[model samples]
Target: MESSSELADIKMVLAALMQGMNDTKGKAQVVEPKQEKPSAESEGVEGEEDVDIVQHETNAEEDKGDEGGLATYMKMHQDFYASLHYTRVQEMCKQKNIQYFRKDMGAWELARLDLQEYKDMLKGGKP
Candidate 1:
């Protein structure tokens, strides 16, 4: 009977996790590239290599995000944050005066807060 109750609790936890994962999966909007009409100067051009347009598009998006703010920077560098140890993240957060849950928060979350704090300091804010 206790085993069955434990299984039910696990199921509830799994359901909540799934919901959170789905919520975090935001749809990225794609910007359409403007197509230019072929000019007579390029009509006879041949043997040129085709560019990876998608790569260029994403680079431009990253550049735009850099100018936007910390949220975008955090998203772009999640892997870097995740790689840090929890203790280091907590220390950095403390040094920067970034509010974080000492026991509940993981390394990546603390690291993100630390990064935002650093960026805010760079921008002359007191975060």
Candidate 2:
């Protein structure tokens, strides 16, 4: 037969083991609430349209040089033209509704007349 002290010690060990298991289970339950999966939109695939819009806006800036008078000037000046940075030139073009082009000159030649008049008027001549 086991001694009373030994039996008491065994009971104490078993009780501690049960308490440890319960603590682990409680911690697991607390952690479960924090492990949620991200929503589809947050993953980006569901927001493809937004991604496309952003891409289109970005591409529009690049394509602006392929459209209007500026494109013609750029073509004519392709070798000697002052290097106009894309953003600054793009802003000017946007504000003036000037078409940007890579090679076409018809519109730019016409626009040059206005610039010449402005310069002439600035110099005290009738535009």
Predicted candidate 2 versus true structure: per-residue lDDT over 1-127, tens digit per residue: 5799899999999999897774654465444457768787569765454445354345676567655344554445433222555555555555666676642232343346455554566568544
lDDT of 1 by residue, 1-127 (tens): 9999999999999999887785534666777999999898777675676667667335777677677557666765565655777676677667766665752354456547657776777878544
lDDT of 2 at 43: 90
Q: lDDT of each prediction vs. the true structure?
A: 0.68, 0.55
Clashing pairs in 2: 68-99, 68-100, 68-101, 71-101, 71-102
> Against the true structure, what is each candidate's TM-score?
0.31, 0.23
Cα shift from native, residue 46, model 1 (Å): 3.3
Q: Which structure among the candidates has the greatest TM-score?
A: 1
